[model samples]
Target: MKTQTLNVGLVGYGMAGRTFHAPLIQAAPGLELTTVVSRDAERVRADLPDVEVLSRAPALFARPDIDLVVIATPNDTHFPLAKAALGAGKHVVVDKPFSITLSEARLLKSLADEGERLLSVFHNRRWDSDFLTLEALLQAGTLGRVVALESRFDRFRPEVTDRWREHHRPGGGIWYDLGPHLLDQARALFGMPKAILLELATSREGAEVDDDFLALLEYEGLRVTLQASSLVAAPTPRFAVHGTRGSYVKYGLDPQEAWLKAGRTPAPGWGEDPLPGCLTLRDGGEPELVSREHAGLPGDYPVYYAGIAEALLHGTPPPVSVDEALEVMTLLEAGLDSYRQGRWMKLKESNGLRKRLHAH
Candidate 1:
């Protein structure tokens, strides 16, 4: 097959845009980071020297040569920017949380369908080393029939900055920021949960929005707990999974984000995680630590853009499908509702109109 190069227009220059999207998109086989829509021309030029920097998103959308528009802007701006991009007949990839609301995500999906453009979410954590390892263990039945899973994205940021993420807005919160990754990973591992119970708190002294959250996703015979906090000095197991046969406990996060922050390009050993997860087996109703050096599967963020390129050029499926992202959005909204009502929110009927709308 002839490789087709797709021109990508990135719509932000913030931490996410500069750190994750730009480098991954550039590293992808058939995608080119051609244009960036940011007010900081000097900063964009400094990182992406040959890329065109546009002051406005509309101008970038109007360009006939741009094949894909990746929205890495603030969470609230995701809906409008993606709507415009899809309307302009460009394939769109939005950063996590899909949108501020389920309605916005559904509308974007509708527009993408009408425009016949491929739409996907950047759930890059799906490719994380720890996650990949757990997924493999589950598939291999190493941990037979996982009954409980705990995932944490804890950090030690005691002070909340004045960024949009920390402001009291629709999309500003740790839940929206990190919840998508955790929720998506859970769903990927155990499919959709029957219900969700969420507890949110503004723990930091100066925090305007929620800086801590603990969500409980209930399955048939499984219980998944997802937690994130801005205050934590000690290390917590990134993933702790237990089942009938054994348990797998892992500490330390995947190294890709840190690597990207250090301005390192993806290459050999890019996603290799040095910290191995400890696996324990049940020995005649007694637990025995078998191996603490179980090698984690390598993480690969570049696979996301590479999948996008193949989807756009050769008719392959996207890395994260639109339907899967809509499911994540449903859980996000349910989490908020659960917190407000102080009860568990059921997801059985949540996919009503949106699922029908996407059926076509």
Candidate 2:
């Protein structure tokens, strides 16, 4: 197989840029980490000594050698940076929450279409081990028809930090931060929800943004709850699913992020599934406990870059398509509405504005 080398220009050297994008882009086989856009030239050089660190976003976009631009900047800059990259005739990959509003996402999608560029959103949680296992079990009917699913991403950060997350601003809350992961996973498992009931609040003392939230997704013969919190010290079941035939419970997080942070890439036991989730099912006389191990697939962040390369070079569809991301954004906006209205909000109705404006 023939492969082409793709020069990548990464914007922003923040936590997301340094920790996630840089490492993954360097690890990808068909991609080259050529240039980075960051004001902190010293830090960028220290971390990525070989790659040239450009000071401004436009400088990187102007480079003829760069084939792809990865945007890991703050929520507000996503739309503008992505638009500029696409307009510069470069492929773009924006981090989660795609943009602050559904309209911004729609606009970027339209702009990408007009410019004939490949655009993708980085919803890395879709590759999470526990999520992958649950998806497989559900697909194989091992859990028989899933009746209810509950997912939780809890933490213990009581005091508001110096980061932008603790502030009360657009895309400055737990919902916009962690909600994308849970909601994206839910939408992946069960399409769009008919209605969403949200209970969002600042449970932590002196916290401006919402530190906790619980969103209930209503589906046919299925009830899904997506939750997150910065106040819960002791987290509960990571994933719990109940089905007609049986139930599966897993109590651990995926190890990819931890391993990556630890600087242990390509090592043995990477992205390994922890263990078989305890299961309860009816065999013949009564319910029995079954311990079945789920197969572990390698967590490859490089796949995102590979998809971008394929899309830009060969005109193939991206890994996370714009339509799929738009669906997630719609649910996110609906969740916000549910939080404010103090009731369930239908996604279709709440997102009608964007849909009508971006109608085919």
Candidate 3:
């Protein structure tokens, strides 16, 4: 057992805080769910009976016992909460879509640097079973030199809810909601794209912001297209990769999120995906394409918090580095520019958005 524990104060007890952050922090070794900042103390207490629940973020931040502050609130509030957390001398973790804008993201980075505190964004999909399998395949040259890849995160919610995500506000859209996962996954696989083109739409009635989107990331020899929709009635392959050697198509989202939402903690078979991805490859001696099912490695969302604990307790680098988080933000902002300009937005050579945006 580890000798140290990082007491985490989660700033929101809303959907994200309750569904994702609280549970993950509780499960992480060397981390304690010390306090939660929420408007609904009853709800928080119903779930985490032992943990303290503060009525406001400032109250939580004032507590000297909190070693880490996790901002899992609404998208727009991420910046202020995280900034305050860092100012309070706490290691920080912000849920995805780090902030609404790249400038905000940079400011947060500067704060973390000045404070010498660990700061990371939660890009949990990196540990998805299918994505993990895909990464292994690419590393093993299973899909030799991938030329084109399509990643889709689709849902069938046609009705617009009154939630902050669906309302008209800065950072209130599907692009910010789901784009980070796809962008981070693409960056993980193919570094920075040479250029990017994005299209967004508000297709549903009563929708205030974009609910459907298609973004194309152009690489030197590869093209990665990321798509998400609110009205996707039929099923779509979650990922389809075409390469020089063969193609691998995987359907179904990683089961971890669903499992977590269903209130199941990590255990044996926790992250297993029932649907195996299929690989189509040319035979050794023939022109025929051989198809086979590829078993995916188990998904491991718990590893993210574990890594955070290790980084704080043992001085290892964070699993989701600030640079990586910035890269995702860079594309996110660039994608918006592409949508606005109706043209491809060019990116810097490498280390996507590590430098300031003036270079791009």
Instruction: Provide the TM-score for each candidate, comma-separated.
Output: 0.95, 0.92, 0.96
Report the lDDT tens digits of candidate 3 across residue range 1-360: 155987889998888888888898999999999898888999999999999988889988888888989999899999998998899888999999899999999999999999999999999999999999998888777767778899999999999988999988889999999999999999987788888999999999899999999999987667789999999999899999998888999999999889889999988777899999999999894889999998879999999999999999999989999988998999999999999999999987664321221111
lDDT of 2 by residue, 174-283 (tens): 99999999998888877777898888888877888888999999876678988888878784888998987777887767777777777665455556765546666676
Which pairs clash in the backbone of model 2? none
Model 2 weakest 10-residue run by lDDT: 351-360
lDDT of 2 at 125: 83
**Per-residue alpha-carbon lDDT of candidate 1 for residues 32-136, written as tens digits (9 for 90 to 100):** 999999999999998878999999999999999989999999999999999999999889999997999999999999999888899999999999999999888
Residue 105 accuracy (lDDT) in model 3: 94
Whole-model Cα lDDT per candidate? 0.90, 0.81, 0.90
In terms of TM-score, the best-performing candidate is 3
Backbone clash count for every predicted candidate, in the order shown = 0, 0, 0
Candidate 2, superposed: residue stretches over 4 Å from native: 1-3, 284-298, 349-360
Q: Candidate 3, 149: how far from true, in Å?
A: 0.2
Between candidates 1 and 2, the lDDT winner: 1
Ranking by TM-score: 3, 1, 2
